[model samples]
Structure formats: C-alpha cells, structure tokens
Target: MVSQSPPQSHQIYPDSDGKPMADNTEQFRWIVTIQQNLDWLFAEDPNVFVAGDLLWYPVEGHREICTAPDTLVVLGRPKGKRGSYKQWEEAGIAPQVVFEILSPSNTLTEMNKKQVFYDRYNVEEYYLYDPDKNDLSGWLRVDRNFDVIDPIDQWVSPRLGIRFSLNETLQIYRPDGRLFLSYIEIAQQVEQERQRAEQERQRAEQESLRAEQERQRAEQERQRADRLAEQLRRMGINPEE
Candidate 1:
C-alpha cells in the first residue's frame, strides 16, 4: 500500500492587499493623525496595541476573511510589530476600537460592507470621518450590537477617554484636554518644548552663578576685616575698641 501524504494547510493572508493605504493627501493625513495621536496617548501602556493600515485576519483557515483598518486599537494585546493581525494568534482578542477615514474613492456599498464586518467582528467602538464634508459618525456597542451615536459631535470615547468635537472640522481632544495635532503640528510643539526647556536650563545656571558670586564677595569682605583687626592688634591698639 502506498503511504498517504498529509493535506496542506491553507496559506496565510498576504500583508498587502494590492490597495494603497490612502487615495489622497487628506485621507492620508487623517489616517496618520488618528494613528499617531492614539500611539502618543497610549505610549506608556504596555498592553495597548495601535496599528494603521494593517490587515486583520479574523478567522482561521479562511485567508479571504481579512480587512485592513485605517486605525485600530487593541487594549489587551502587547505592543510590537506584526505583519498582519491574525485573531487566532492574538489569543482571540479583537480590536476594541477602529477608525475609518472616508476618501473620495470610497463608495456607499464599500462602507456598508466594512461596517458589517466590523460589527460582526465585535468591535466595541467604530468611528468614521469625512474630511471633505466635515462629517463625523460613531457607533458604540450596545447589547452585543453596534448602534449609531446620534449627533456624534461632542462624543467621548469610553475606551480611550478622548472626546470628538465636530465644528467646521473634526477635532479630537485627549484626556488631558490637548487637541490631537497633525504630524507637523506635533513637531512644532516638540520644538517649542525643547526651546522652553533650554531656556529654563539657562536660567537655572545663571541663578547658580549669581549665588556663587555673592558667596565669594561675602568671603572676601570677611577676610579684609579680619586682616585690619590683626594689623591693629599688631600695632598695640585695642582692635575691639
């Protein structure tokens, strides 16, 4: 009898789905702003995982069941590099928060499919922003189903503790009341902070130098007075008088 070979397992999903992460500058900016701000907010947390444009595989043995979210946050996962987020390999913890930035190329049908996928995959919070129209929408999980949040403006995210305000444009505020900044804005703020720190350092050094000078002046005056008293005593005069 011929020996039978074991059946081959299905191949893993590709990291790249042959689609660009963003279609234009505005879309890319939104993606980066959301992803980077979230990263900054959770930088100190060891278990918060933030990823942008990373393919997420939610099912095992089905390579086609995957979607790449614009920005995703997983609360229980460790921070690290991943080619793709395979749910089975991640201890079955789905991303708790997902952000989608709408581009001009996105169609209603495409967005509907994405919404269904996220809802079925157990995402706790879902946010969508349209930069061109200045529209913001959100959904929060209730009774194991995602429900639309009416009047998304001034909505606060439960998991992140960040607030979303939509006026002329979408604005996100951190827990500490700082606005979510773009890449350029963040860099400028860093530079300003560096300058302020440098100025503080210089001021401290100057204060230390002034204190040393005052101490030296006092020491010199005391030495001169002592010398005069010694000379008077040497000349047979009552120095005390």
Candidate 2:
C-alpha cells in the first residue's frame, strides 16, 4: 500500500527569515554518514526501509508525532519515496528501528523526550550516536519494553547481521568479513570490478587466438603427412605405417 502522511505545515521561508528550525554542523555530518550507508545497507538487506527528512505521524489527532528521524529503518516495509509514514496508515505499525545522531545544540531534556516518545510508540530498536565523543549507545525492546544495550569496542547489530567496527576509523562489515564499502569506497569498488572483468575478457580472447593458431598448425602437419603417405605408395611399399 502507498504511504499516507498527514498534511504538511510548510511555508516558503528562506534562511534570512530566521525560521524556527534547528540546523547544526554536527547534525549535517551525521546525516552524511547515514546517507552514505543507505545504499550499502539496502543492498545487504532489501526488506529494510531507510528514510530521512520525512514525516512520521504516531498519532493522528493526538499531540505526538515525529518526523525526519535523521535515519530510521522499518523492516518488512517497502523501500521507496514517501511524503511521510503515518502509523495508522501502515497497518497500524510503527517503525521498528530508530536512530538519533546527537548534535551539540541538543539538550539532555530534549533527548530524553525523544527517548520517551520512542518507548511509548513501540519502536523496537533505538540507537543514539554521538560522533563528536565517538559515543554510541543503543537499546533494544524486549516484550515491547525498552532495555539499555551497552556499546562495545566493536558494535554489532543484532538485527541487521552487520558489524560496525573501527580499524583506525569506523568501518562496516561485508558478508565475507571484508570491510563494507563507504560511499566513495563503493564507487572505487565498482570501477575495480569493471576493470577486472575487462581483463578477463581480454584473457579469454587471447586464449581463443592461441587455440586457432594451434588448429592451423595441426592442419598443415596433417597435409604434410598425407603428401608423405602418397609418395610412399608410389614407391611400391606398404604405406600404412
């Protein structure tokens, strides 16, 4: 089914207007990281839904709703563009996963409120990441209840089967244990795969050429043998040998 987001309260106000929206550099950096991993994570698992800058309505008429979860994933949901995800419209199901990237402008009280909202809405998994402090703490819901999941030296996602570890820097896991590609790294990998394929094609062509040359040489030798046999027959001796 298609997404059914509530009507947006949007206005065409520029930066000069001093609009009432929060924007910060730390937030932008976290967004970049999430955006970069979107395709990789999607490739690894298609059932996962990743969204950013979108609206989510937990309650239709009540006063609680969240939008644009820096990054979020709803397992078993269709991956596509949507104006917003209205909880009531999505089979009365809320997002299974939610991630919050911390910004310096955010306060302890504000973060606590978001945590409470997620707990009330039944978000199955909640993760809070602080890039500045390299702090990543998470919680997993058990029996519809939130429980703290402590961060470790190497973060492993129990739900996604993906590992996030630092090897001098934060790196994701590939299925075969190699590092998962970052945005730029993925691009380079694609190019390298293409080059390797081209090299294989060239090798195949060279092998074919060598095979043809060998066939021609064999044909010439056969002809020479036939001529010798004919000469032996003319000399009046048994030519079978």
Candidate 3:
C-alpha cells in the first residue's frame, strides 16, 4: 500500500503587520449574518458554498494566505470546514464571488490592496456593501482587469440562479417565490408560524371532543326518562290518566 506524506504547514499572522483585517464585532456580525443567509438559501442549491472570513492562499510555491471575507461564494467547492483555503488544493480555482462589507476601520488602501489580490487570483466578481451610507458597489473581472459595474437596485447572479434585490429591505428571492431572510429573521418567523398552527390544531380537537361528550350525555338522559316512564306504567298508576 502507498503511504501518505504529512500535509504541508501554513503560516497565519494575527495581523498583516498592523494591517486591517476582520477583527472587530461589527464586521464580524455582518459576515456571520450574510453567511447564514446564504447557507439556507443554497441548501436547496448546493452547487455553491458561501463562507465568512477564512484564510485563503492562492499560489502553490508561495505560502498562500487569506482570511474570511465579509462573504465569499465558491461556485463548485463542497460546503464544509477547513483551517484555511489553499488555491492549488482546490483545483486552482478561487472564489467566484467575494464580498466585503465596509466598516469605519477599513481604509482605501487596504480595500484596494484586496482588490488587486483577488484580481490576480482570477476571482470573477467582487461586491462591497457599506452600511454607514448604504454604499453598494460591485465589480466584474474583465480581460485581466477589475471593472466596476453600475450599482443595480436589483440583479441576478448567473452563478447561483438567485435574484438579489435591495428594496427598502435587502431580500434574496428564490425562483419558487420563497424568500430567504437573515438567519435570525427566518428563525423568528418560523417559530411564530409554528406556534400559531399548533394553537389552531389544539382548538379544533377540543371542540370536537366537546361536541362528542354533549351527544353522549343527551342520549343517556333520554334513556333514563324512558325507563322511569315504563316503571310508572307497570305500577298500575295510570300516568296518562
């Protein structure tokens, strides 16, 4: 039998030498929310996997390095856990969609640096969301260059076949007309609907039991009256007279 060699080691620096990374609560929460939403949405569509800030290394000879994005979508990778993403390990495929949610801590230089990194790695799309001023921007990789796409109030992802819309509320709707909300919102709504349905079923069952008991009582009373009348008739006291 062939023996397997030990896996290669990778280096992880807590900070990029004072570089800005996903280390704060606000950035962390947005990433988590987006990831959970995408997970539920793609459960029925598993070809794509979405992840929040994780390490990714793009080249083989160089010790590749990356951390989770605000949200990242890989078109063909199986959804699962890993210490980090190694480009060569993934058939030389990088994430097709990468998202960055802007926070006060992020500077233009840092953001631009990531843009160049993703571009060199052949990422197909890059999207950014800024909650501060609600700045939403998107870009597509074209001919070895990253070109910005005009912000669309609504658009469709050719990769996942789902529509992304920014109405008064941000919503992602599936083709079957079902809506996918953030994990917290989806869980709360499902719980409410379940409670309502259970209450209705209980009420209906109670009403059925009540009606059955009343019918049985009425029948018993009628039989008792008949027996008393027969007893009086047999006693030679002419009740009719």
lDDT of each: 0.94, 0.69, 0.72
Provide C-alpha RMSD values for all models, in order. 3.3, 6.4, 6.1
- Runs off by more than 4 Å, candidate 3: 1-25, 45-47, 64-67, 142-145, 167-180, 214-241
- Write model 1 residue lDDT over 1-241, tens digit each, in one string: 8985333255647899999999999999999999999999999999999999999999877778889999999999999999999999899999999999999999999999999999999999999999999999899999999999997788889999999998889999999999999999999999999999999999999999999999999999999999999999999997788
Q: Which stretches of candidate 1 lie over 4 Å from their true place?
A: 1-8
Top lDDT: which candidate number? 1
Please report the TM-score between candidate 3 and the true structure: 0.74
Give each model a TM-score.
0.92, 0.76, 0.74
Q: How well does candidate 3 score on lDDT at residue 229? A: 79
Angstrom error at residue 197, model 3: 2.8
Ranked candidates, highest lDDT first: 1, 3, 2
| TM-score-based ranking | 1, 2, 3
**Which predicted model would earn the best TM-score?**
1
lDDT, candidate 2, 1-241, per-residue tens: 8975455433221212222123676566566566556545676666667776456677755424455566677777777766677666577778877777787778999889888888888888777777777677778888878988765446667666556674444555744576655456668889999999999999999999999999999999999999998989999966886
